[model samples]
Target: MKKYFYNNIKSKALLLTLASITLFSACEKNDDLKIAPPTTISDADIFKSPARIEGLVNGIYKALKGASLYGGRFLLYQDARGEDFINVTANNYTAYEAWNNSYSSGSNDINNLWGAAYTAINNANIVIEGLAANPGVVTAQKTSEYVAEAKLVRALAYYSLIISFGQPYNKDGGASKGVPLRLKAENGPENNNLARSSVAQVYAQIIKDLNEAEAALPQNYTSNELNTTRAHTSTAIALKTRVYLTTNQWSKVIEEAVKLVPQTQAPFSTTATAVKHALQTNIANIFASDYTSVESIFSIPMSTLDSYTGQSAIAYIYNTNSEFYVNPTGILGDAQWGSTDRRRSFLRLSSGKQFFRKYAKPSPFLDYIPVIRYAEVLLNYAEAAAKTGNLVLAQNLLRAVHQRSDASYVFPAAAISTETALIETIWKERRIEFIGEGFRGPDLLRNLQPLPAKGDSNLQTPAVPLTAENYIFPAPNTELSTNKLY
Candidate 1:
């Protein structure tokens, strides 16, 4: 992880120097004039200019899109671990190990993912510390906002790491060992020997970061693109709902959710000052050409010039070649997911196989990957409502999501007759709503449920019980080899 901090600093410094040279070349017209760029830039120099500071801030977000992290593999690995998809190709380069629950500490998948997440975390830490040390690089307001943005990114990275590498908070109230908590910036190997913090400790820090971020983040950005792609006050609150839900803080989920989802009925929308978010009237519209829909609370923006390549593209793995297909015996087999439901439209059939179509951009897939959606906030609130015995609001919230996808469909009496049944329905709705978006594994683990077995006799994978060693990913060998205290 410290290696990542070192590399990021050097690379970003080079980028800043090159940018400065380009700007100078554009403005200077003296034919004989020459300017020598610095061979090396200190950390202080990187934060000396507003443009340089902004570049570092953007780099923190760029780190989140690493191929092994949110670019594609993280979502693919999570869904593969669930029962929804069957692996058509048993290639380990993909998520075959995750699908079969066979990954070890030395596995490339675990190591790469661990490295990617920590790289993002460390980068955010660097920006946070750098900005603090040089307070006037930007306006006090801009400085606070930048630091808040870094905190939000760091909090998210830590949350992702904890859920993947540590036991479920519900399982032991977060008593299990978690990945090392690296709060301070480290630019060299000197600080590589850190011990793991308990899962509870990590959660506490995540919450602390989020609370501070929410306090300082803007209510919304000037444009829809920025609102969907960057951190905002609503984004922080939305994420808090998810974090609180995973920790089974039922009331806390409600508390945070209502901040964005203030309405008590259908067509629920956020009361944010500039960026008003509500469920898209047409569920398919969110995944269509326009990915900047208000429904998208936060998403990783991708373009032809900057997007996942090769097998790392979500469309390539799930749709283009059908590496994984919807399991006939899994959620696709759920009778409740009626054929008339509009969400079923996301499924495609070619050469006698069913594939997901949410990410349908061909070749160089440029589809924006959703990080969180307003729909998720509604459902998160609904689940918490049911868990807290507010079945009426829970049923109403569940109906909002269900009816949005299938307006004509009505819930059977038995499905919503009790609180437990309503909660179960909400979970099922989540699986259907977020099939290719990567909420399956985390949802199951948060509930302490087993990762159900899938596949036919030819490529069957066994069920991973909650107590299984592979239930949560092992700490990668990369960290174990470097961190002596680990």
Candidate 2:
């Protein structure tokens, strides 16, 4: 029952000078303003040092990658909620409850994910507020970049929450209810209880934030991994493509995606920007540990020293010895892309069971959690082209992804002549290419498809339909008691 919304958590970077505060303990409307410790560092004291400001930003990133956030359950739940995995009765993993779509509003997985996402959002809110208040703490350019990064992370967290707790944006013409959009820092008790926004309104705010971020973020970084892991102008552009796609802004998707992924080479690439995000010769090696390939636009780092373990780690649940096993029978389990398709090798057989190796398990389950990727950018460009009747360019982009994986899997032009066919091809490739990386549930929802039915006779969770109620998880019971708006 720990309240992560205002928990006093710490990261490796002990900027405790800014730590040790729980914002909502009183639960009284007036007390909500009391976000910091009674004698916490003053704004002047903390903001005078650039290191402290950076530490606050670092803390936000750490919260974003928490076990309940992207660190584990958020992505893991999305994958399980999709139709790719087999829900065998014998495989009674407690975590699979999300995969089965049978969990209640009281479920810990649902509640924790809800709380953790908001916590990350709150962290970003604090950074945004701090940076804005102390305009003279850093150079104009540095301040712009840092504040831009905070906005980028906050936008991402909001989008993730909207996806998990609201209906698809395309459904009902974007009129569906979205989760509470917490933008301002809740440092005081100023009527903080707010109702949900419309899905359309949320997207509008997200777009506003991303546009600001894209304009302010640095165009280049000194190091490759640093560029891949942190927010930058290209990251904002790449993420915009995804946001546009989900909101069904076809033309906008093409416009933003083309900036990152070109028809022949990676876009947003130049001697100045240095975003060389084209496919590597071998797609199989893209997920190699400690290596940041040209295709990784933005990812959260994980390693031996900073890796997820126990049930919260994605690799832990996907392990054959654990509650799940790779299915060997469906189009998902055994799709015949080509004999030489590199992705076909992504699934591995261990201890008499096939396991998904897409995230690329290190000795201790620490594959980087990708948020937006170059491969996805490419697909976004292709899908947008297909949707807008630019069939030739669409096919070229789609074929580029296919050949990158197999090198010889030639996609015939006539096979995907119609827009529907080409779009389907791109979607299928996205599903296969990102297997176990957590796109299955989202893909299904965006496409308005039914959740994969229970593959086991003994399990009794019914098939999930394309209803708004089923699409969004209910507000967690914790919120009901704590959040006045609920």
> TM-score of predicted model 1?
0.93
lDDT of each: 0.83, 0.70
lDDT of 1 by residue, 283-360 (tens): 888887667888898888776446777777888888887888888888888867889999988999877767888888
Quality of model 1 by C-alpha lDDT: 0.83
Q: Which residues of candidate 1, in runs, are more than 4 Å off?
A: 1-40
Please give, for residues 1-486, the per-residue lDDT of candidate 2 as tens digits: 111234111111222344443321111121211234434565456667786686677667777787777776677778777656664433323366776676677878777887777777777877787788888888888988878888888888888888778888877777987877778765443434677788888888899999999999998676776777778888898889888988778999988876765545423232324676766667667676434666777877775546777667776666533455555443454343665688877667766656766665745776777787777877888888889888888887877778777766766665689998778778878877787777777777777778766554455346788863665567777666555764
Worst 10 residues of 2 by lDDT: 24-33
| CA displacement after TM-score superposition, residue 414 of candidate 1 (Å) | 0.6
Q: Could you tell me the lDDT of residue 486 within candidate 2?
A: 48
Per-model TM values vs. the true structure: 0.93, 0.87
